[model samples]
Target chain A: MKPSSLLAPVLALAPASAMAGSISIDLPRLPVAEYHRPYVAIWIEGAGIQPRTVAVWYDADHRGDPGTKWLSDLRGWWRVAGRNIGTPPSGISGATRAPGHHTIPLPADLKPGAYTLKVEAARETGGRELVSVPFTLPRTGGKGAGNGAGGEIGAVAVTLP
Target chain B: MANFIMFKSLALLVGASALALPMTASAHRQWLLPVATTYSGEDPWASVDAAVSNDLFFPDHFPIQLAQIKVTAPDGTAGAIEHGITARHRSTFDVHLTQPGTWKIGTEGFNVMGSFKVDGVEKRVGRRPGPPPGAMGPGGAPAGTPGGAPGRAPVESVALDAIPANAADLKLTEAISRNEIFVTRGAPTTALFKPSGKGLEFDPLTHPDDLVANEPGKFRFLIDGQPAKGLKLTVIPGGKRYRDAEGGYDVTTDANGVATVKWTGAGMYWMTISATDNKPTTPRATERRMTYTATVEVMAP
Candidate 1:
């Protein structure tokens, strides 16, 4: 089934309180011998099987669409959310970021529910790592955040503010 | 002058012979199969079909004894596999799945030995198991040097007059295979994916139990405890059906001993790493070659 058709209803039912909130994630630098910008896959895995992809930081060089092939290496998100969606999906995809903190704002009209922010990274000739943060978006809206760490991608956090 | 000319031609041919030869090792493939892919509900049970065959991808026939098999549950509890009915092609054994998670099923400690005879003396090669005392014929090579670890014996033939009188010549080959299957009664745990660090282990940094297709991931290699750099690991999505498919994933561990590969389509992936050394064992074969194999189930997209 197409992910858009499934997300359409949930997006429309989202309340106004969640609109002002943005889910920012911190992507820390690692201390490995070799370093490269990791292709990061950030998505929200809800109570159900389908997930809402927030962003894909990848090699957007687009010279011949070379980087698109390795995007699937983000196995967890690719299988569940990235495959069916458009390659770049315009706003949702962008060039990879250097090691530091980055933020992805939640959809203004997203429905309230429990979700796990799964952040996975993979780099060529480097290690792969995953960090997950569980959170909930109550319709009433307040504050929610979580943090995790990995080998390739260091400290990772998701915050709703 | 004529003899010198003939020797020069022979020397030139010998120097270029390797380039003209297609050398392939006479190697066998190991396989581990779970009766069913996934089991539901409480008290799930699993049984694996294990075999070693000359053909790496097919069970056309079994050519070697299975030797030993063990399964480590998700909780890190390990137990010898209780063998059940055996057939010409495979051996079946039960795996306890009292806890819900991925179970690491494996086989190790099997040696395939080969040897030769010179001057009426049979020299044992492969593994360190020495022949019985007084079993050697008079004037035969003593059962290896009676000192430090056995040294490598050349697999190739040596001149009879060149054979040492006190030490026997032998080459030892070892095999290790690791297979995994996931059982879900509820949530999965990290305990199921921990590495034993015994042989060539692929400690998944991507959580093997929850692998997803199109997901590029890394698995750290531990060969005999330390990081195994330059270890060759081949990842076949459908190892049993390898010949039936197209390109398979293959990589060598970096200096850090980590192999990274991305899953395209989901299926059962068989990853094998093999290594050899010229150094012989303490009491047995002249040289040793070791191999490790793992069967990973990649969940479909």
Candidate 2:
């Protein structure tokens, strides 16, 4: 019963359900002269959790662009999930994107249970990648959210027809 | 007569193999000038060759010398100014640019090896896509080159105000250890200069991969840009001097311009600095040079 007492009741039920629930992001495809459509970031976590950054994209003026300098090749989405999205609530204040495919949505006081999805890609002279996906949210009105180890085991699916 | 005594023992064996070599100066060495340390390959009037090797302190290896080849034009009309050069060897470090882009030739002589500088004309070495104040590569077609633009009237930019290039400094103050994974690159990273204060005294220990220790002072270093030399300077510490424990800071310039270097010793030492207008050509010196590079951390005193 000690992972620090299971992290003190999951940090007292994660800031009270950590904002209540919703998410979707599917980007990944490259090849156009080795590839030149990079600069992406998306966030959320809780599976070994500690990441929350919402969004980031770049290509503004293209001078060999490496944005945040290869964004750390996304190392397992920056250590299991962007160090748990440190400061994230909204997303990218500075925008820029071109090569295609991008979709963002996951806000509505997000809270329920299982949630960890992250993606990071950077390129100027080339290369970087990070990916993580998981889901399970139920209980805004209450009921639904199931999956031990707390969320995201598939490409990300939080079914609730 | 025993063939004239074997030709007098082959003339004493060819004068003892010409007195065992040595004395090999043979006129003006090469001078491609990328800050002059020996480089040749920029090609314009085409003819950049220098090799006075074994560093004699670059005064142009005497031998009927007179050299003078300056280019210095980073948007400041000191464009291609060539003058007097004897002791020949494929000659012509020329300079007659009406103007275009990137031109920093700079060379001088008192027999050879005096000045330095390179990276002239429409620059393009390889793989450099965004990593500065402004760089967004993949701009579509600049990959190989061809008539990108050229036809006179684009050569009147010489706003070099002699040397007052925004007082150089590259911050130093330590107290790291939240996780221990720091990084460095060309000190202060404005591409080797500019960090007199806060660009990053601490930003997650600055990690891109950090490894910019641009060798000691590199030599003849820059001033208006860094390690300057006219208003003279020598404050080098924009690198990881072995991760500082208290060892970073060293500036050098004296005779008047008051250049002193320090940082004593400690951890993370990748320190680099330069600023040369420190003049010295025997005609009583004072030509010009400008270098840069910054990385920080020093905490041992």
Candidate 3:
């Protein structure tokens, strides 16, 4: 019997998070204002609106938790993509992110289907932008690449990886 | 430090020569950041009085652990304001030097560090936050960062909604409502609510609370008899725990519609929900909003 088993409960406190396939969001270079990294929402939309992943490069959750609460701030994604949800579901989440690059993997147990990924960005004193990427994941292997639907507006839907 | 409660009165004198209407009655609310100083000088250990846009009733009711206040002084003493949150709107910071200088407060200046121009100098990295690096050790991976570190959890979902005209309004919504994550294994599941729609301004977590408000206003816990107040709330601008002081707060309303005292440092916490009133133009009474929806509607029928 491995002695490590004795302290499994203590180890259980630190749950292991799944590495969902990451997504790369490219910001548009606006001539006018500075573009702060946006609060991007990636979710599997079905039965109206359901949020699967919230990738806010700039906000926060519990105490020091970081993530996005300003789904509406992502102008383009707000209309059809990142709206309705007020808080995140149990399990995994955090505060927001700063201006730069962010990568998030797809959930292994993600129900395979026509899932949509929504990306929205907003700066406190600057501009707002949104981009949606739609993808279809394989039932078994987490193999896929998100389609790049880059632009600026209220909502832009991109196909799944 | 002394506390201040600003009774915002947004009186917009609009000349409606086109409509020929008598002083148009528009409801308005002034974004009043009533600052108080422990010692008065140019900036004298000043703290920008922040509310969760909602007030918190109990200790567990407040959110927003700490706030990152960045200021660029005229002489250029480049430093960010780190305020320890307390009972929602009742928050205060040491005010560092408390000297006078030009200050521009915003979210995410440069990287995770507080980087602003001080006499044309930049910090380049996040300031030396408190609580040290250990706090994030359990879940300190740069959240939302693609291929983030191991300590943190991966983002499971992200969706956009209700795109606002300007970034500030949208950022406010994100800062208040959508940006929350509850730990299942930890303290019985907490929901950190940032009453304001800005980065870590006022992020406070309520025990076992999964719901929060996007717009500022009054909110009832429903589970408890007390109402969840919406003062202004925030978290450490970045998820950096060291920068945050008390972790959360709420501005509970007393009989005079103000908080009791100022915010001092404490411990870990979540977001706060208070009565965040909308700045209605004229003819509009102080239109109050509740961050969390209640069974009883305040709308006068």
Candidate 4:
């Protein structure tokens, strides 16, 4: 028997953390009249696999989670992926941020596959914007990245390494 | 923005004098006129006449900015439209229809504001209409005030001056208007009707480009992808400089969020609907409102 075949089963038994990597997203500022930090939802969606939410930037710090009610307003994300994420998210959620670049590391449980990184943002009294970056996760360990733009979001660059 | 206010105010003043209406009442109409609805060839060049008229159908005879217009292809791609030639009564854009499906041509987010500052407090001026039912009620106001009609979604712009701007409060009045058109060549496509996620949207059960004059059609109203009921709709015939008091048709959606309307004329048609949430959880304005407008060219039998 080939030794590589024997090692294939051993590799399958290893934890997914052995393939973990990090992604950084650069977000530029928008010049609008009434500017506010956007409620951003970043996640990975792929064919035949459950969506993995990397981070959700919203007004979670608000009292009683009043902002959560508007979560459904995100439409595409909420209907396709967000609702699946349970309430009181332990670590995947955070507060909104001012205009600038930010980074989010992938979870250890992420498996190697073809996935799309999606970022959707909605601001108060402002338009809603969505951008998607397609990427491939290598088996061992590597990197992939892409970029786009929107009215409410600018200079959207995603890097997985 | 400044030009929009002037044109709108001019129309309002003219309508107010003719109808003997209150200063708070605004009567501006937006219309789209196509050189022809149906073409015989594969590639057709069309000139569309666009304007913000007075009352129901009369031409406003004012200048309209071309930057306010947008066009959507049959494949659902939306983009800004320029290269318009402005005349005395209307502005026109030349559209080359190369696709074999429906195209949506329209304009939105046109707003006019009248503001006054007092005591460092910037107060809104004009009429503050109540919110639509099932959404937010009138912000900080009683349920049924004399400010506006029920079933009418409050304009995105509010007139805090309805309470009268005194020494303590600044007064302002804002009016917003939106317009659109649905035109098709061969098969009908739903790409142009995608929900913007910022306002009320029309989910057409019957193809807008397929509607024939005097034929019945069905439509559904949606907000955030959910069926919304009790929404009011207005439909008006195109290519007119004036209209009677009962010129347009008005109807409200049923429990299933369906509104049925039959055509009466063989011309371009304008349909509009609006929804508003007056009480927002955010710290900004007390109301959030959205208005949707669409134009469809109905074929003549």
Best by TM-score: 1
lDDT of 1 by residue, A85-112 (tens): 6365767888888877666676665567
Candidate 4 A-chain TM? 0.75
lDDT of 3 by residue, B35-81 (tens): 31111111134344322222121221112223433444334456555
Worst 10 residues of 3 chain A by lDDT: A7-16
What's the fnat for candidate 4, on a 0 to 1 scale? 0.00
| Stretches > 4 Å off in candidate 2 | A1-129, A132-154, A158-161, B1-284, B288-301
DockQ of 3: 0.01
User: Which prediction has the highest lDDT against the true structure?
Assistant: 4
- Which stretches of model 1 miss by more than 4 angstroms? A1-161, B1-28, B35-40, B53-58, B63-67, B80-83, B112-122, B126-165, B168-199, B239-246, B278-281, B284-286
Relative to the true structure, candidate 3 reaches a TM of 0.26
Error of 1 at B135 (Å): 30
What count of clashes does model 1 give? 17
Cα TM-score per model? 0.49, 0.20, 0.26, 0.47
Backbone-clash count (model 2)? 102
Give a tens-digit lDDT track for model 1, residues B1-301. Answer: 5433333332332222212222233234466766544443334557777664444445554412334456667677874465565555677777656766566666545443555665646664333333332333333333344431246342333433344655444433333334444443233556755566555566667655556576766887776667889977777655434455534667888888888877767776667676666543434444445556666667654
After superposition, the stretches of candidate 3 with alpha carbons farther than 4 Å from their true spots are A1-20, A28-35, A47-49, A61-71, A75-100, A139-145, A149-161, B1-301
lDDT of each: 0.57, 0.32, 0.31, 0.58
